[model samples]
Target: MAMTVVTGSASGIGAATFSALAASGREVVGVDLRDAEILADLSTPEGRQAAVDTVLARSSGVLDGLVLCAGLGPQVSDAKRIVAVNYFGTVSLLDGLLPALRGGEAPAAVAVSSVSSTQITWADNPIAGLDESEVEAALEVGGDYRGQLAYAASKNALTVAVRQRAGDWGAAGVRLNTVAPGAVDTPLLQAGLDDPRYGEAIRSFVGPLGRRGRPEEIASLICYLLGPAAGFVHGAQFVIDGGVDAQFRPTAF
Candidate 1:
C-alpha cells in the first residue's frame, strides 16, 4: 500500500484528507498534537524532529505522499507562534522528509496556505525574507495588527518557498504544490467567527458562493493533487476560495 504522512490530521481539512486517503486504502500516518498516530506539535523544533523521525520509522524511510496541513490562524494571540507553526513548521518537516519522498514511487507533497496571502501588503511585511533572527525580530515588535500580518506573511512565504523549490524538487522526482483556501468552514473558521474583532470582516468575504467551503471539498482537491494524474502540476498554488479573492482583488492575483 502507498504510505502517506499528513500533519494536523486530527482536525478540519487534515482530518478530512486523512479519512479520504484511508478509505482509498492508503497506509496513512497522521501527525497532530492529539488523537493521531503521531502525536507531536509542529510549532517547536523538537516536536517537528520527533514527528519526522517517527514518520521515517513508520514508512521505513520511504514515503509516497506528504500533506502539510498544520497551521495557525490570524486570530492567534502570539505572532511568533503563528510564524513558528505556519511557516517554519511546514518548511522544516518538508525538508526533513525530502529523502523519504525521493525514495518513493512518484512522490508528491501539498501544503495548505491561505487566501490571506494575496491580501497582504508587500511593504513592511514581516514574513518576507524570513531567517531565524528575522522571524524573532519581527515577533518582538509584532502587536495586534502585526499578528494578522504575520499570518498572511507566513502563508505567502510558504507559497513562494514551494514554488521556488519546484525545480529542485522536480529533479529529485518529487512534486511540490500549495493549496490556498478561502473562508473554509472548519474549527479555524469557527474560531474566527467567534472572535468579535474579525468575525464580521471574515463573514463579509464569503465570495460569490455566499457560503463557507466544507473540509471535504478542500480534501478532495488535495487528494487529486497528490495522485498520479496531477504529475504535471508542480510548484503551483491552487486557490479554492469560492470567489472571495476574485471579487475583491480580481486583478491583483
Candidate 2:
C-alpha cells in the first residue's frame, strides 16, 4: 500500500494537496494543528513526533512520501515564530520521517517554500548557523517590523537544506526537493489581501497570470513531482509563481 504524510492539511495548499494525494490511490495521513485524525503542531517537537508516529502506525512502519506544506508568512508577534514553523519545523519533521522514508519504495519528499525567498541572497544569510533559541532572540527586537524578512529567510534556509540533503538521501534511493509558490489565493493570504494598500499591490503583482493561483493548481504540480513522472528531478526548487518573479519591481516606466 502506498502511504503518504501531509502537513498543514486543515486548509489551503496542504488540504488541497492531501485531497489530491488521497485521490491518487495513496493512503494519506494528514497532520494539522486542528482536531483532525493526524493533528499536530509542526512547530513543536512533540507535535512533529506525534505526526510521524501516526504515519508509521498507519503505514505499518513505512512511508512513501512526505509533503512539508505546514508554514506561515510572519503572522506572529515575533519573527522567530515564523522560523520555527517554516524552517525548523520542516527540518525537524524531515529528520523524524527519515527512517520511515528509507524503508519505502522510491521515497520522495516535497517541501513547500515561497517565491518571496527569491529576494534573499543565498550568500549572506546571518541565521544560517543560528540555533532555534538564537532565532527566538533575534525576534526580540519589537517595533513596526512585519517579520516578512524572516518569512523569506526561513524559506531560503529550507531551500538550502533540501538541496544539501538531496545527495545524501539519493544514496539511499530517496528524493528530496522543494516547490516555491507564488501568490496563491489561500485563506492565509486573506490577512494581507484584506489590507487596502497591500491588497491593491498584490492584485497587480500577479500580472499575466491575471489572478491569484488556485490551491488545486499547485497541488497538481506537487503530486506530479512526488510521483514517477519527475523521476530524474531531485534537489531542485520548482518555481510556480506565474512569472511574477520576473516582474519589474523597481521600475517607473
Candidate 3:
C-alpha cells in the first residue's frame, strides 16, 4: 500500500488533493497549520522539522508519496514570510522526509508550483543550493515588498529544484515532479479576486475557459501524478492552465 503525505491539507487545493488521495485508498496523511497532526509554522526551520516529525509519526516511518502543495502567493505582504513558507519550508520538509521515502516502495514526490513561474526568467541566478542563512540574506535584499516577482522567482526555483531532485532520488527509486496551477477558485483566488484593484479585469481575461478552475480539477491532476499511472513521468512540471499561457501575448504577433 502506498502511504501519502499532503501538505496544506487544511483547505483549498491541498485539502481537495488530500480528499482525492484518501478516496483512492492510499494511506493519506494531511498536514496543515489547522488540522495538521504536526503543528508548526513553515516560516521557521523548527516548524519545518516539526512537520516532518509529525508525518513520520503519523505514517509510522514509511513514506511512499509526498505532495508539496502548501504555499503562499504574492498576495501576501510579507516577502520574507513568503520565501520562508513557500520556498525554504518546502525544501526543509522534503529534506527531512526524503530519507524515509528512499526506503519506501516506489516513492514519489510532487510539488505545487505556480503558472507564474512560466512568466519569469531567473536562469543564472538559481534559487536552489543556497543555505538557510543565504535565504535570509536574500530576504533582506528582497525586503517586505518583493511582490509578484519574488513569488514567481520562488516558484520557478521550486520547479527547477524538483527536476534536480529527480536525479538525486532516482537511484533510490524515488521520483520527484511539480504541478503549476493557473488561476483557481480557492480562498486564495477569491481573496485576490475580491481585491477590486487586482481582480475584475484580470479575472475576465483569464476566464476565457469560462471561469476559474475548481479545486477538484487541480486535485484530479495531483492524484494522477502521485498514482502508479504516472510511473514513467519524472522531473517534469505540468502546467494546469486553461490555455491561458498559450494565448498570452504581450502584443499582436
Candidate 4:
C-alpha cells in the first residue's frame, strides 16, 4: 500500500482528504494539532521538525504522497503566526519530507493555497521578498492590518515556491503542485464567519456557482492531482473556487 502524510488532517479539507485516501486503501498518516496519528503544531520550527521526524520514522523513510493543508486564515489576529504556519510551516514540512518522498514510488505532493491570494493586492507587500528578520520587522510595523496581508502573501508565496521547485521535483520523480480554493464551507470558513472583522466579507463573496464549496469537492481535485492520471499535470496551480476566479479575474490567472 502507498503511504501518505497529510497535515491539518484533523479537520476541513485535510480531514476530508484523509478519509477519502483511507477509503481508497492507502496507508494514510495524519498530522494536526489534535485527533490525528501524528499530533504536532505546524506553526513553529520545532513543531515542524517534530512532525517531520515522526512521519519519516512512521513511514520508514518512504512516502508516496504528501498534502499540506495546515494554515491560518485572514481573520486570524496574529500576523506573524499566520505567515509562520501558512508559508514557512508548509515549506519547511515539504522540504523535510522530500528525501522520504524521493525514496518512494512515483511520489507526489499537493499544497493548499487560497483564491484570496489573487483577490488581495500584494505588489508592495513587504513579506514577499523579505528574509526571516525582515518579515518580522515588517509584520511588527504593519500593526492592525498585518494579518490580512500575511494571509495573502503567504498563499501567493506558496504558489510561487511550488512552481519554482517543480523542475527539481520532476527530476527526482516527485511531482509538486498547488490548489487554490475559494470560499469553502469548512471549519476554517466557519471561523471566518464567526469573526466580526471578516465575517461580512466572507459572507458576501460568492462564486458563479452561487454557493460555498464542500470539502469533498476540493478533496476530489487534490486526489486526482496525486494519482496516475496527473502524470503530466505538474507545476500547476489549480483554482477550484466555484468559478469565482473566472468571474472576477477572468484573464488574471
Cα TM-score per model: 0.95, 0.91, 0.89, 0.95
Off by over 4 Å in 1: 121-124, 139-142
**Any residue pairs clashing in model 2, and if so which?**
none
| Candidate 3 Cα misplacement greater than 4 A, ranges | 124-145, 204-208, 249-253
Tell me the tens digit of each residue's lDDT in model 3 across 1-253: 7478888888899999988988888888777788865567888888888888877777778898999888886767766576777778887888788888987888888889988777656563335566656654564544544545557778877777777788787777888888888888888777666766557745764734766688899999988887789999888988787867667843521
* lDDT of candidate model 2 versus the reference: 0.81
- Over 89-152, each residue of candidate 4 has an lDDT whose tens digit, in order, gives 9999989999999998878999999986675555756677677556767766556767777888
Q: After superposition, how far is residue 168 of candidate 4 from its true place, in Å?
A: 0.7
For candidate 4, list the clashing residue pairs, or say none.
Answer: none
Model 3 local distance difference test score: 0.77
After superposition, the stretches of candidate 2 with alpha carbons farther than 4 Å from their true spots are: 139-143, 195-201, 248-253
lDDT of each: 0.88, 0.81, 0.77, 0.88
Runs of candidate 4 exceeding 4 Å displacement: 120-123, 140-143
Tens-place lDDT digits, model 2, residues 96-207: 8888899988889999998766666667555676888788665444334446667777888889888889878888888888999888888877766775535665667675
Per-candidate Cα RMSD to the true structure, in Å, reads 1.5, 3.0, 3.0, 1.4
